[model samples]
Target: MSRNKGGRPPKNEGQKIKQAHLRLTEDQHKKLMQLEDQIGLNRTDLFIKRVLENQDFIITKDVLIQLAKVGAEMGKVGSNINQLAKHANTIIKNHQLPPEIVAQYNDLLGLHLVQERELYKVLRQMYRVMKN
Candidate 1:
């Protein structure tokens, strides 16, 4: 009988739950932002990858471009789902919908899965780079 309370899920007891806040100089912030935008990682993740995990690796522009494409495709998929839901609601006001709704849902789900696969491949490539 697991139930969510509608907020953030509880964290494990032993997890790394601490947070840090830092202020950097203008030049330092600029350099960090450049790496963040180019590598598709935020400051915390970049620090973890470089300092904590010690997985220093160079990421080319191609990887970032591929990630951007995956992200754009995901946005389009979400828009399509929202439009389908709106149309279905308009047609099924106080009535049962037909089976095509399930088909539409499945199609959207399949599209999202394909995009996830692409994202996974990019992550795998990054992992391979890290292992070297």
Candidate 2:
């Protein structure tokens, strides 16, 4: 077998290295640390990756988590609406539904409408965040 070279791989022969000096405020530093933790990159690597890749810098983990939660809530609301629709259809087919069943269905439909409105608000908030 050939002898192994244990050190780091050689840099590209045509590449030139440059150094930058940056000063960060306390808040800036904290934000940087949060990004580093979320992205799983060190400060230098994160800076280099961002510069070289021209990546979009938006949507933190917290925002993503919130969006996920909103999606889950929307899904639950949709499932509930579907169930209500099925129940309403069954009542219509029977043509002899009790008053209490009709009232309960109307109440649940109102509640689902409120949930849908809230979901729309969340979706709008997400759109605004993405637009910026």
> Model 1: runs farther than 4 Å from truth?
1-58, 94-96, 114-121, 124-132
Best by TM-score: 2
lDDT winner among the candidates? 1
lDDT of 2 at 33: 90
lDDT per residue for candidate 1 within 40-125, as digits (tens), equals 77787788778877776767576668768977887887888789788888878978888787688878788878977887787898
What's the lDDT for candidate 1?
Answer: 0.79
The ten-residue window of minimal lDDT in model 2 covers 52-61
**TM-score of every candidate:** 0.40, 0.49
For candidate 2, lDDT tens digit of each residue in 35-59?
8888666777677657765555544
TM match of model 2 to true structure: 0.49
What local lDDT does model 2 show for residue 96? 74
